[model samples]
Every structure is written in structure tokens, then in C-alpha cells.
Target chain A: MRKRWVIGILAALMVLLSFKKERLFTEPSGWPEAVYDFKRNPPDPAKIEIGRLLFYDPVLSRDSTISCGSCHLQYTAFAHVDHRLSHGISDRIGTRNAPALVNLAWARDFMWDGAVNHLDVQALAPIANPDEMDESIAHVVAKLQKTERYPALFYAAYGDSAIKTEYVLKSLSQFMLTFVSANSRYDRVKKGLDTFTAKEAKGYALFRTHCSSCHTEPLFTNQRYEYNGLPIDDSLQDWGRMRITRRSADSLRFKVPTLRNIEFSYPYMHDGRFKSLHQVLNHYASGIQQAPALPPSLQKGIPLSGSDKAELVAFLLTLTDREFLYNNAFSFRGR
Target chain B: MRFFLLYLLFSGVIAARCQEVNVRVTASFSGKPLLLESFYQLPGGDSIAFDGVRFYISDIALYLGDKRVYTEKDSYHLVDVSDEVTTHFRVSATQHFDKIVFHLGIDSATSTSGALGGDLDPGKGMFWTWQSGYINCKIEGRSNRCPTRHHDFSLHLGGYSGADLAIQEIALPVSPGDIVINLPLDKFLAAIDLRRQHTVMSPGPGAVALSKTLAALFEVSR
Candidate 1:
């Protein structure tokens, strides 16, 4: 009887030890707490791997020709490069440019229009969109269930071969929550390890004076929609936040994009009309269209000299974190 | 031996008497019972046919006078006129309660929490893809009075924010036996001008107004 008791206690200890794995995500120093409810879907190595596979697989699309990685490439900080607009399955063009995927665990809302509220459900938009994947969650689960590789993967992640939508979404969130970009030059300077050059420092001062109110620090975004005074696109007639809120006051307001990897994730703004930092600076300096919904700070437009523009661009480039762009862990592994 | 047998018999009687009760919901277009794809005449002399009618009922609580006795956990239910399997729910309570209260839509807690399973799942087509809230009520049908395509009207009502909150609490007097809740479609149509505002796909002022009308349409028969 004592031997049996000792064996039972040892087995229980082993079970407890198995559950106490090292933390997969660590909060960046001096940053706000993550908005994602990690308690509901705790991270596991197996689940994150499964989510990474799902992210790379084209089976998510209707024609099995487009995967999330097709639009979001890691080298460009997980944003689509070159194309002003996103290209989807069957070579179809999407309305908006794909935003960079970094530090998403801190975001309460996703998309330029703030359409998706949670990270777990953000994948659904791309999957169901006709121009994008156009595949249903139920169909995706069914397809995965038939695959020999996925059943084993699902069992390892969730302890069951039953591949449900909830598990799929949770796993995807687990993978995405690991995308923390806090290693930029700006971050290193703040941590007292590096000092900015004269031009970068001057640009940082200009940014604090002009752009810090909307694109606030350490996350580099206030996560609110603002009208930066871009004139309406005649063809698309995109009304930005008004499409979601339906309020005239919210017209032309778009969720401010993070500048963490601005060097690589170019073709800026909601429509990606500006291809270069020079064009974006010129828009702020002289091209702000007068509108009722325009932000008060940009009402008279940002006054910047030629050198000021160059300095601002120099500072913006310091935000590019090469560690994140070249991280091999986020890359696709062969089957 | 005799005493043990008597005790067992007494406990059995008590168990039977204190068993849980089921509340079955049935939809109707006025006084008549409603069936899927059933045609009914409006008071305005226009004919209408309902292809689907479903809504979420959640956060149920049993009140004994001023004191609360029972509250159900994970109590979200999607009641559909088309699905007989989800039309009924069991309410278990040891004590007597004079009234029961419930919300028309999911509470703010569940609405804010990301991706849930079963009835609250997005697979049920009750969730908004762009926004992050549950559709409180979905009423889809074809009416000759409607001027839109296929003469169809679809109202999906739910909101979580202030001034746009569509979830309403309703209290109904009840007894311990089986209960039947009636959702009167005719009264709901009469309350709103479907021609002027037939379709509401998202949460806003329009959805909140229709949800108020829907909240008043339920009558419990004990």
C-alpha cells in the first residue's frame, strides 16, 4: 500500500512538472500590459507551431493558391511589400494595403478601419473575404481533419484529434501574440544602451513635437482613429472609420499605422498612395486637405524645412528592427 | 431493515417532487402557432413569410420576491424557430421562485471575451465578422410590403456600448412547473414600420430601437 502511494505521488509530481513549462511570451520592459487575454488561451509550443504551419499553408484560401504569408512577408516586418494594394488569391486585388503585423498583442483592434476587435478573430476576415482566402472556418477544419499530418499536430497541441474552429483560432492567436517588436534603435536608446546620432536626435525631437500626440510612445500608437487630411479617393470613395462607426464626425479617420518597421513596411497610409517617406513628409508639410473631421494639430499643416524632413526620415529609419525582420523562428519550415 | 426501506422510499418521493423543470419556447405570429416558411397576413393587408427567426437569451436568474435564489452559469442559449433541438432548456432549483429574469442578448462579459464555443461560436452565423459582438436577435423574412430585392427584410440587432445597448432585461412571473414563452411576431411587426426600416445588419441606433421592440414581444405563460 505504501509503495502504491509513493508511485502515485511521483506520477502526480511528473504531471505537475510537465504543465510548468517556461513562458513563451515575455512583456517588453516599460510597456503597458498586453490587451490579449492570455489566461483564456495559454500559449503552448505545439500550438504555436501548428498556428505557424496554418499561417503558411495555402489551403486556407478557396483555390489553395494564397496563404497569409503571401500577403504578409516577414522580411518587410510581415507586411506586403511593393504593391500599394494587397494581392489575394487568383491575382485579385484587395481594397486596402496589408498592415504590418508586429506588437499585435498590445492592440485592442485590428485592421486599418478597426473592423476586427480581437486578435483571435482577426484571421476570419482574411479567410472569409472573397478577394482574399474565401474559405469557411468549418471547411478549413474538415480539410485539416482528413490530413494525416494535421491530426497528429492537433493531438499534440490540444490533446485531441478533433480540429475545431475554437482551437484553430486560439492557436493562431498564440502564434501572433509572440510577435513582439521592442528591439528597435529607439528602444535601445531608451534602455540606455545606445545613443542617437545628431540627425536622428534632431528628428526624434521633431517627432515628439509634431507626431507624438497621435503616434504615442513605447507602442508608438494611441490605437485611435484620426483624420490626417488625405483627400477622398475618387474611385474607391473610402470613408475610413465612418464605414464602421457611421458617424459623420468619424469621417476620413483611419487607425494610425505603427512606425516600428517603417523602413521596410513602406507604401504608407490606408490606401498606400505614398511610396516613400519623402512623399509622406511632403503630405504632412504642405498637402493636408482642409476637412471638417481633420485633427486639430494638423489643421494648419506641419511646418518642416527641407533639412527637417530629412532628419524626420532619418529618425523614422531608426525604428526598423532588423532582429525582427530576419528572425528565423518566424520563417516557414519544410513539411 | 424495515427502517432503511422506509427511508429510501421517503427520499425517492422527495427527489421526484424537487426535480428540475423545463421551459419550452414556441414562436407564433399572433394567436396562431408559427411554423417555418409559414405565411401570415399583416394588419396592413400585406402578406409575409418568415424563413428564419432566431435570437440569443442569456444571464438567466430566478428571483424569490426581492431575493435572488438561482442563477445559471454559462447560460447563453440560441433559440431558433427552425431548430426543435434548441427550443427547450431545463431550469433546476431547489426553492420556489415567484419570478424569473433574463437578458435578450449576451451580457457584456461574454461579448468582450474572445472566441467562445457551442452556441456563442461564430460558426452559428450569429456573430459579426467585422465587429466583435453577438447579434442579439435575427429576424429574416420576405414581405410584399418591403420594396427591396426579393421583398426581403433582415434585422440583426445587438449592441454593447452606451446609448447603443440593445440587450434588455425582462422579468416574468412564473410557477415551478413546465413553462412556455411566446414570441409574438405580429405584434413586433406592428410596433415597427418594416417598409421604412426593414433591415438592420449592425449595432447602432436602428438596432437598439428594434431590440426594444423585440424585448417587449416576449410573454411567458406559466
Candidate 2:
């Protein structure tokens, strides 16, 4: 009896330790509390697997030719490259660039205009957009119910075979919440595990002086709307946040995107007008369109010489996390 | 014998306190029951037919004059015109309430609470996909005066922010037993010109105006 009791306690301890080892999401050493309320929809391994499968599944679209992964690829830090604007169903072009899906667990709001208020409902925007998936949440649930694999997968995650809108959305969030990108070289340097070169150090100083106000560090975004002084595109005529708020004061403002993985996630800005980092830096230095909405920091413009631009680019490269880009866990494994 | 008599009395009091009341909601046009897809003559001489009519009724409570009495728990009912089962629900309330109070739409706190199940689910087609907010009241129909495609007029009224908060609270005096609430479609149609204002697919000043108009049409018949 004594031996049995000792063995039982050891087994319980082992199970507890293994459960801790298998946690999917862990906040980095010095990060603020995540805005996403995890207590409502805690991460489950089975649910994360379902979310990963759904992310790559084209059945979420009206036609089976598009998926969330089509616009958000894992290699380019989960952002679309090669296209200036987002390409959706039937080769339809979207007005805004497909923003990177990085460190989304920390985001208070989604989209360039802050239209989507929560991450749980964020997938609904692309699914229902005429230019994108063009599918309704109800229809998507029906499609998932009819699928051979989805019912079983949902059952595994939710303990029921009936696929529901809540289950589908919550599961997708579970997968995306695992997309924490805090393992970059800059993060390592911050931890004193690595050191920046002289040029990178100069660029870091420049970034701190000029860009840190809006693209605040750690998560790399202050998560606020700002007019970055880009001239209005006559063709698109997109009013950004003003369209959502219906206020003239918010006319040219867009959500400040994170600069993490800026090396790969280019064709930048809300409209994706700047093709390269040099063009973006040059625009900050010289190409700012004069406007009353322009932020006071960029009222004059960033003063960067040709060499300073190169140094800034070097610092930006340090923001890229190769482990996050190449993580096999995020990649599609075919059924 | 005395102990048994007291036990019986206590059980009777418990049963009376937990008594359930049924609330039935019905839609009508000019004092007649309105049927979906059936043409009705508008006061303005234009014909109208409803394809769908649905709205959320939430935060139901009972009162004695201005004093609070009882409030329903988890009180959200999606009254869809096509589904008679959704039009009525039971609420637990004791006798002696002079007034009934309820909101015509979901409260702002519940709207932003993120993904929910049951009647508030996104699968219900009452949630806007492009923006995050429950469509508190949706009325999709066709009118001869409407100049748009298929002569259709779709009004999805909902907003949970500063100027756009569209939920309307309605209080009605009642004597109590079972209650029946009637929504007159004629009053709703009389307030709007379908030719000029056909579509209100999103929340704004237009939706807020329509919500108020719709809220005023609800009446309780004892």
C-alpha cells in the first residue's frame, strides 16, 4: 500500500510537469499583459490543430480557390509579398495591403482602419468580403459540418461533432494566439544574449529618436491611428479610419503597423505603395505630403542622409525572426 | 399534524415565488396578423411584402410603479417572424407587477463581449461581418416605391458607440397573467418613405432613426 501511494504521487507530478512543458503560448520575459482575454477561450492543443487546418483550408471561401494562408503566408512572416495589394477570390484586388499576422495576441483591434474590434470576429471580415473569401459565417459552418474531417476535428476540440460559429472562431483564435514573434535578434540583444554591430547601433539610435513614438518597441506598435503623410491615392480614394468613424478629423489616419519582420513583409504601408525599405525611409526623409493631419513629429520630416538610411535598414533587418518564419508548426501538413 | 400542515404551507409559498409568466410577441399590419411574403397595402398606397423581420429583445424586468421588483436572468430573446417558437418565452416572476420593462436591442456591454453562442451567435445572420456589432433589428422586404434592385429595402439597425448607440428601452404598464406584445407594421411603414430611404445596411444616424421608429410601434395588450 505504501509503494502504491508513492507511485501515484510520482505519476501525478510527471503529468503536471508534462502539461507545463506543452503550453502553446508563453509571454516573453519583459512583455505587457496580452489584451486578448485568454480566460474566456483558453488554448487547447486539439483546438489549435483545428485552427491550423482551417487556416489552410480553402472551404472557408465561396470558391475553393482561396484560403487565409493564400494572403498570409508563413515564410514572409505571415504577410503577402509580390503583390502591392491583397489578391483575393477570382483574382479580385483588395484596396488595402494584407497586413502581417504577427504577435496578434497583443493586438487590441484588427485591420488598418480598426474596423474589427476583436480577434475572435476578425476572420469574419475576410470571409465575408466580396473581394476576398465572399463566404458567410453561417455558410462556412454548414460547409464544415458536411466535411468528413471537420466534424471529427471539431468534436476533438469542442467535445461535440456539431460545428458551430463560436467553435470555429474560437479555434481559429487558438491557432493565431500561438503566433508570438518575440525571438528576433533585437530581442536577443535586449536580453544581452547578443550584441548589435556599430551600424546597427547607429540605426537603433535613429529608430529610437524618430520612429519609436508610433512604432513603439517590444510589440513594435503603439496600436493607435496616425496620418503618416502619404498623399491620397486618387484611384482608391480610401479615407482609412474616417470611413469607419465618419469624422473628417480622422480622414487620413490608419493603424500604425508593427515594424517586426519588416525585412520580408514589404511592399509596405496601408496601400503598399513603397516597394522597399529604402523607399519607405526616403519617404520619411523627403516625400511626406504636407497636411494638417500629419503628426507633429513628421511635420518637418525625418532627416536621414544616404548612409543613415543604410544604417536604419540594417537595424530593421534585426527585427526579422527566422525561427518564426520557418516554424514547421505553423506550416500546412496535408491531410 | 401541526408539523405536516406547516410543511405544506411552506411548499405553497415556494411554488408561488417561482411562478413562471409567459410573454407572447406577434407582428401585425393594421390590426390583422401579418404573414411573410404576403402583400399588404401601405397607408401611402404602395404595396409592401416582408421577406424577413427579426429583432432582439433583451434585459427584461418587472417593476411596481418606479420601484424595482424582479429581473430576468440571461434575458435575450431573438423574435424572428418566421419562427413562432422564438416569438414567445417564459420568465419567472411573482404576481403584483404594475409595469414591464425591456430593451428593443442588445445592450452595448454584451455586444462587445466577443464570440457568443445560442441566439447571439454569428450564425444567426444578425451579426455584421465587416464591422463588429450585433444587428439589433433587421427588416428586409420589398416595396413598390423602392427604386433599388428587386424593389428590396434592407434595414439592419445596430451601433454601440457614442452617437450611434441605438438600443431603445421600452416600458409598458401591465396588470399581469400572460402578456401579449404587438408590433404594428403599418406604424413602421408610415414613418418612412421607402422611395427615398430604401437601404440602411449598416449602423449610423439612419439606423438610429429607424430603431426609434420601430421601438415606438411595440404595444402591450392585456
Candidate 3:
């Protein structure tokens, strides 16, 4: 028993050494503690590179027609611009708009109705959705394994070259998670290196009063599902949050969108109903739809005037995130 | 003097680590060898055999008295059910354990951030894309009640936040020499009365209900 005890102690030290794996991510100073707890499974550079390759690869879709980047373009904060709703493989139109994939680590929930709860698995929905990538996970894994490029890439990223479902999804998630939208002009201003112009600052004040309650600052979202007062369109009739919960009370409670990088993340709202900030401001000012799920803050329909609208638009533009848009580090590699 | 004491301590640690014992952990669903169909009983008894089933067992630990022995390097295994008859797990640890504890899924840190490859890779069907989360539990099988005509059910169950959390802890014994803990199929009966339902494929109240039963299989005996 004593000998066994000594052996036990030594074995534990080995595990301690193994578990002492290096942390691949750092909580950038002044940023909130990440919603993703990297301590349990640390991020590795190898995995991130693999994820980047997959992100740009079209192998994730059926018929080899679409990649995740198809709808989530980098120039537009990963939000699609060609259509009001997302268009996927075989030209299938989805019911809801594809929200910009920005600063997702800070998000509380995912999807218009918050159907998904974790970031690693979010890709499964689009990959498997018939109206989207239209590909099955098993089929995709086989396809990836057969691809000459993927095997080499997987070997470089992960020591073993075997292409399985878990590695593919995790690698893609690594790339998406690193697509952090933290380098905007607003970020610089927040860091105290710069100041907002008069129009921008004035607009900022109006934003704080009229919209900050839901589309909060910094991260620019509370990350809760809220009824933003969007009236249901007769043609699409997308019910937003109600579809997930089957609760009448949640008839239209869509996940609150981040106002960060709003300038580039337009046509706003769940359905991409508005093409410009002015229209969004107009809806906020007086076009709120009345319903039980209408957020308590917007029930009064923000009482801003024409000048206020102009000021709000200027403030929204401050969130353009120029560095995020043009950052060469995030650009297509070997393109 | 400090260096001398440190050398003595380090030597003892290395010596202890050199000694090891092997333990086997076999877990199956119901009384039968686990087929994806018999296991995942979702809402409304729509039972179906799945195309696949995958899960991870992490943080296997050994406790001898107050001290704990850990699996240093590769302590996780993604059990694939394709050709293997039993989900056989033979672990060699550098510790004499009086007890053992492990997790049924990869811990929280690995589920988010950075990219992962191999068993933890996202390309694996176990991960979710729309919600950007890992599906720690995957069960696909045939069921009559499924809306998909194949009579097939794909239940990807795992969520960390809110009420949908599925991670659970299991504790067992290391046995003085060789210890084998069996997570038999009957535990499914312990967890659910399959007569009521056979299908649960998404994240909600149903997944949590089933995972509770799954966590009850750990035993601390030698």
C-alpha cells in the first residue's frame, strides 16, 4: 500500500505537468472576462490556422457551392449584403437575416431566437440546415478527408491528419472566435487615445439616452433576447423568438444585436429590413410596433426629432470599426 | 540546503510517477451493447437508431488518501462506436488510486475559443455552428416519431449556460491493483423509464433530464 501510495503521487505529478498546458488566449486588458472559458481547453495557434483555412474553404457545403464566408462577408462585418434574408446552397433563401459575426465571445446567446447556447457548435446549424450549406456532418468529414488540401492543412494544424467531425467544427470555431471585432475607431476612442468629433459625441449622447438600454455601449449589446418593436412582415412573417420557445409572450423577442461596428453591420434588425441607419433611426424614433413583447424601453417610441436622427446616425457611424474592416491580419491568405 | 531538499522532493515525485496501475472503464447504454437507437430516448417516445454516437471522457483523476494523481498528457479519449463491441477504456496512470473521478464531456475551457483538431475539432458533427457551441453528447438512431422521414433521430445534447448545462462529475475507485468500473446499460433504466419516450435530439429540458440519469453510473468501490 505504501509503495502504491508513492506511485500514485508520482503519477499525479505527471498529470499536473500535462494539465499545465500553455494558455493560447489572453483577456485583452479592459475587455470583459470572455464568455468562453479558455482554461478548460486552451486555444492553440495550430487549431486557429486550421479554422481559418476551413473558414475560407468551400468544402463545408453540399454541392461545393458555399462556405460560411459566403453569407458572412468580411467587408460587411460578416453580414450578408445581397439579400434581405440569408441565401445558402442551391439558392435557398432562409427565413431570417444573417447577423454580423462580430465580437461573438461577448455575446450572451446566439441566433435570432437564441436557439444555440455555445459557440463551438454554432456552425452545425448552417452546415446541416437544408436551406443553408445543405451538407451533413458525416458527409462533410468524408469530403474533407478526401480533399488533398485539407489533410495537409489538418496535419499542419493538428499533429494527426485524421479529418473527423470534432476537429473540423472546433477548427472552424477557432477561426470564428478569433474574428474579434475589437479594433475599431470606437475602440481607440474608448482607450482614450482619441476623441469623438462634435457631431459624433452629440450623437453618442443621444444614443445613450434613446438606445443604450438595449444596444448598450462598449460591447454595444446587453446580449438578451428583446422585442425591438419590429413589425412582422406579411410576406415572410418570421416570428423571431416565439418560434423557438413556443411561448406567446415571446412572440418576437429576438436576440439583441451589438451596435459595435454598426456602420458596417447594416441593414439592421433580424430580417435586414432597413438598408441604412436613417431608416433604423426612423423606426426607433416613431415606427415601433405595439405588442406584448415590445421592450418596455421602446414602447414610447424614442421621441427623437430630425436633428436627433442626424446626430444618432453620426454616432452610429463612429462604430464603423475601420481597423476591423481593413486589418491585413484578417485578410484572405495567399489570395 | 534548499537545493538539497528540493532534489529529494523531486526525486521522490519522479519515483512515485514511475509506478503505475491500469484501470478499465466500460460504459454502455441499457442492458445491451450501446447502439445509438436504444440510448437516446427524446421527447414523446420517438425512438430511432442513430447514424452515430460520440462523447468525450475527461479529467480522469486518482485519489490515494488526501493526495490526487492526475493523467498528465493525454487523459481524454473520444470513444467511437463503429466497429468496437464495447466502449473499452484501458487507462494507465502513474498513481495508486483509492478513488477516481472524471467528466463525461470536455471541460468548459475547451468548448470555446481558439480552434481544435482531432477528436475535439469542429468539423466533427458533434459541434454546433449556429450557436457556436460544442455538442458534448451526440446520439443518432432510428425512431418512428421523428419528423424526419428516415425514422432517424440525431440528438446533439450539450449546452453550458443557463438551464441547459450538461456537464456532470463521476467518481469511482482505483482499486488497490486493477479496477474495472462498468457503466452498464441498465443505468439507462435507472435514469429513464424508456416506456414513456425514446427520442430527445435538441437542447432543452429533455436533454438535461436524460443526462441526469447518465451521471448516476459512477461507483466508488475498489
* Maximum-lDDT candidate: 2
DockQ of 3: 0.25
What CAPRI grade goes to candidate 2?
A: medium
TM-score for chain A of every candidate model? 0.93, 0.94, 0.90
- Superior by TM-score: candidate 1 or candidate 3: 1
Query: What's the i-RMS of each model?
Result: 1.3, 0.8, 4.4
Give all candidates' CA lDDT scores: 0.87, 0.90, 0.71
Tens-digit lDDT string for candidate 1 (A108-225) = 8888888787888898889888888988877888888998899999988888898888888888888888888889999999999999999999999999999999989988899999
RMSD of each: 3.6, 3.2, 9.0
lDDT of 2 by residue, A128-205 (tens): 999999989899999999988899988877889988999999989989989989999999999999999999999999
Better of 1 and 3 by DockQ: 1
Cα lDDT tens digits for candidate 1, B1-222: 999999999999888646687878778887877877878999868999998999998988888898898898888899997798898999887677878889899877777788788888776778777677789999999999999999999999987766777899988888777778889888898899879888899889999988888888899864
Among these predicted structures, which one has the highest TM-score?
2
RMSD to native, candidate 1: 3.6
> Could you give candidate 3's per-residue lDDT for residues A30-64 as a string of tens digits?
87867864553456677777777777777889888
lDDT of 3 by residue, B136-182 (tens): 66655655654555655555667655576677778765557666655
